[model samples]
Target: MSDVLAADSATIGEPAVNISIFGVFVLITLVITFRASRNNKSAADYYAAGRNISGQQNGLAIAGDYLSAASFLGIAGAIAVYGYDGFLYSIGFLVAWLVALLLVAELMRNTARFTMADVLAFRMRQRPVRMAAAISTLAVSLFYLLAQMAGAGGLVTLLLGVSGEAAQAVVVTVVGALMIFYVLVGGMRGTTYVQIIKASLLIVGAFVMTVWVLGKYGFNLSSLIGGAQDLAVEGRDVAAPGAQYGATGTSKLDFVSLGLALVLGTAGLPHVLMRFYTVPTAKDARRSVVWAIWLIGIFYLFSLIIGYGAGALVGPERILAAPGAVNAAAPLLAFELGGTVLLGIIAGVAFATILAVVAGLTITASASFAHDVYASVIKKGQVTGNGEVRVARITAVVIGAVSIGLGILALQAGINIAFLVALAFAVAASANLPTILYTLFWRNFTTQGALWSIYGGLIACVTLIIFSPVVSGAPVNPVTGVSPSLIQDVDFSWFPLNNPGLVSIPLSFFLGWLGSKLSKERPDELKSAELEVRAFTGIGAEKAVAH
Candidate 1:
C-alpha cells in the first residue's frame, strides 16, 4: 500500500499534452451541443429530438451511450487483472442487447412517447403506475451514474497527474458540471450528436490500440495470450477461467447472479429504452438496434485484445500500484506502447466516453421525473410542452449534483466500475423487467402488479445489496490491509453472495404474478386492446400520447 501511494504520484501523462488534448475535445463537444440546442423549441425536441434522428445516426448514438466507462476503463482493467472471468462482462453485455432487439425495442418505440412510464401507464391507472415507474427509472439511472462518475474521477486524475481523494472529488464535480451543461443546453439532440462523435472516437481509438498491441506479438493472438500468461503473477493464468471469480461455491453463485442481471437488465434500462423513442418509427428502432449490435460487437472484440495486451505489456503489479488502481490499466498500457502522445489521445477519448454516457443518463432520469412524475401526475396533464422542458432542466441539475457526491464516495470505496455497473443491472432487472414483460405480453396484467413488482423488487434487491459482502463483509486484501467492501472495517453482511440478481429477479417475477392474481381492480379493456394493437402493428403510433 505504501508503494502504491508512492507510485501514484508518478506522471501518467505529460501534463501539457494531456490537458491540451482533453481541452480540445471538451471544446469541440460543447460547440456541437450549443449548435444542436438551437432547435429545442418544444418538449418533443428536448426529450426525443423531435423523433427526427435517422436510424443509423441513432444507432451510433446508442453505441456511444451504451459503451460507457465500464466498457473501456473498468472491463479492460478487470481483464488485465482477472483474465477470462473479466471477459464475461463483455459477453453478458453484448448478448443482453438481443433481449432489447427482440422483445422491447420496436414495441416501445411504437407505444410510448417520452419515457418508459408512458408505456407502463398506457392501460393501467395512470398516476400510480407512472409514479412507480418513474421511481424505478431514477433508481437505475443513479446507480449507473455512480459508475460513470467514478470512472471520470479516476481517468481525469491520472491524465492530469494528480493524486489524492480531494483531487478526484474535484475531477468528479467538473465532470458532473459538464454533463449538466450537455443535457440542459443540448437536450436529446445535442446529447445524441455528442454520443455519435464519441462513439466514433472510442471505436477508432480501441481499434488502433488493438492493432498496435497485436503487431507486437507478430499479429498472433496465441503468442499474445502466451506472453500475457508468462507475465502473470506466479500461479496465475490469464488464459484460464478462475483468476477472479472461481475460487469458491459462493463466488460461482455470484457469477451466476451477475450473468442473470446483465442478460435481462439491458431491456429494462430506462436510458437505453428511452433511446428507442429518438428514432422516427418502429422500423427505424429495429434498424438502430441492428446497427448498434454490429458496432458494439466489433468493439468488444477489440476489447478482448486490448485487455490481454495490457496484462502482457503493462503487467498486473504496475496496474495494481497505479493511482486509480485497476482502472489505470489501459492508460498505463498506452503510455508503455507510445509514450506521452498516445497516452494523451487515449485519455482524451476516455474522458469523452465518460461525458457522453453520463449526459445520456442525466437526461433519462430527469425526463422520467419531469415528464412522468411532474407533468403527468403532479400537473395532471395540464402543463405545456415548454413548461415540462423547464422542469426537466431543473431536474437535470439536481441529479447531477447528487451523482457527484455519490461518485466521490464510490471512488473512496475502490470498487471496480464494471462490478458497480453489474449491480445497477441487477436493480434494473429486479425492479423493471418483469413488470415490463407482463405489461406487454399479458392482457390480465393490472396496475397492482406493476406496483408490486417495481416497489417490491426494488426494495428487496436494495436490501440484499446493503447486507451483501459487497457492502460490508468482504475479506481484506492482504497487500492493502483493507476490506474491499464499500463500508469497510465492519462485517455486517448477511447475504453470502456478492450479487442479489439470482434471488431478487425470481422474487420480482413471482410478485408480479401474485399481485395481478390478487388484485380485483380490473384493467380497462379498450386501452389494453389499443396497446396490444399499437405495440404489434404500429397502428396509430404517431399520436401515441394523445390520450
Candidate 2:
C-alpha cells in the first residue's frame, strides 16, 4: 500500500510541468510588480498605495492576502482527515471579518495614516506607544510569515519531487528572496496588485475543482458526504463533530481558545488593519471588507466541497503518507481530478498564494519598524518621507532573511502551517486588540495602559506559548510514533491549552484597565476629542494623510 501510494504521487507530481507553470506565474507577477513600482514616488505611495485603490479592487486584494496557504492547503487537508471538526477553521476565519468590519476597518481608515501604530499612538505618548505597537506588529508578522514560508518549502518540495532538508531549505530561501524583491521594489502598491492577481487565480481554481468534484459525486452534496464517510475507519464519523478536538476535556477547551483567537484576531492583525489605509475613504475601507467577506465566504464554500472530495477520492491514509502530509490534500485532489495539467496549475497557484501572502507580511513588518519605531520614536518624527521609505526597503531585506532561517527551522520541525497561523492570531488578539479597543472607547485610557496592554499581553501570550503543548510535551501519535509539538525529545511544557487566547486575551484586557487606574499621567482631553472626531467623522483625516 505504501509502495502504491509512492508510485501514484510520483506519477501525478510532474516536475517539468509544475516548474513551467510556476515560472509563468512568477514572470507575470514580476512584471505587474515592476509596473506598479513606477508610481511609488512618496512614502504614502510606498506605504499605502497613495490611498487611490477603489472599494472593489482593495476588496479583492484583501481576499488575496487573507486567503492564504493555510486557507487552501491547510484547512482542506484538515477536513479531509478530521472531518466536520476541520471546518471550524473556515467558520472562525470568515466570522473574523465581521469583527474587523464593525469594530476596526472604517474607523482605522479614518484615523490612521499608515500602520496600526498611527491610531494606537494618537492619544498616548508617541514614543512609547509607537515602540510597543511596532514590536507587536513585527512579532505577529514574523509568526505569520513563518507559516507561509514553511508552506512554500513543503509545497515546492512536493511539486518537484525533491526529498532532503537542503532542497526544502533552498525552496524556502527562494520564496523569501522573491518576497523581499516584491517589497523592496514594488512596495505596498505592487504587493496589492500581486494579491489581487493571486486572489483571482485562487478563487477561479478552487471553483473549477469544486465543480469537478461535485460532478464526480453525481452533483449531490449528500453523495459526496456519504462517500467521504464510507472511507472512515470503523466507529469514526467524518460527518460528525469531535473527530479531532472533542475526545478529551483539554482538547475541547483548546477548541474554544482557538475560536477566540480567530474571531478576534483579524481586527488586531497588523497586516489586515494596514489594508484599510490603502483605500481613499472610510467608506471605501468598509466596502473593501464587505467585498472581502463575500469573496472569502464563497471560496470557503468551495473549500468544503474540495475537502470532502479529497477525503472520498484520495483518502486520509494516502494523504498522511504523501510528501507534504496533510498539506498535500488539495494538490493530490487536483491530480486526481485532471491529471498532470490540473496538478501543475494548482501547484503554481498555491505557490503564488504563498508568495503574495509573504510579500504582504514582509511589507507590513518593515513598514511598522520604519514608520513607527525608526521615524516616530527614534528620529522623533524628524525623518523625511523618502528616507523613511529607504529604511523600510532595508528592513524588508533583513526581515526576509530572518523569515527564511525561521522557515527552515519550522520545516525541519514538521509543524503544520495552519496551526502556526492560529498561534499568530493568538498573539495579535492578545497583544493588540485590548489596547485598540481601550484607546477607541475608554475615555480614561492612558499611556501606561497602552504599554501594559501591548507589552504585557505580548509577553504573557508568548511566554504561555513557549510553555504550552504546542511547543513541547505532546504525546506521540501512536500510528506515526512522532510528537506533534514543534520541539521533540523534551517535555518542558506546563500550560495545558494548545492556544493561549482563552487566558491571555482576558488577562490583557484586565491589565489595561488596571494600568489605567494606576497611572498618574492623566489622559489628554484635547487629543482624545480630536481622535474621536477624526475617527468617526473623517473631517480632517484626508488632509492629515496628504503629501
Model 2 misplaced regions, further than 4 Å: 1-11, 233-235
How badly does each model clash, as a count of residue pairs?
0, 0
Over 279-330, each residue of candidate 1 has an lDDT whose tens digit, in order, gives 8889999999999999999999998898899999988888876667778888
Q: How would you encode candidate 2's per-residue C-alpha lDDT over 1-547 as one tens digit per residue?
A: 2332232345356677877888899999999999999999999999899899999999999999989988998889889887798899999999999999999998899984899999988888899999999999999999999888888887777777666667678778987888788888898899899899899999999999999999998899999999988876456798999987989999999999999999999899999998999999899999999999999999999999999999999888777666667788898899889988898899889888788888889889999999999998889889999999999999999988998998887776666678889999999999999999999888899999999999989999999999998889988865445787878899999999999999999999999999999999989999999988998889889778873
Q: Which stretches in model 1 have alpha-carbon errors above 4 Å?
A: 1-11, 545-547
For candidate 2, the lDDT comes to 0.88
lDDT of 2 at 534: 90
Among the numbered candidates, top lDDT falls to 1
Estimate every model's Cα lDDT from 0 to 1.
Answer: 0.89, 0.88
Candidate 2 structure, TM-score to reference: 0.97
Task: Candidate 2: give the clashing pairs.
Answer: none
- Measured against the true structure, the TM-scores of the candidates, in listed sequence, are 0.97, 0.97
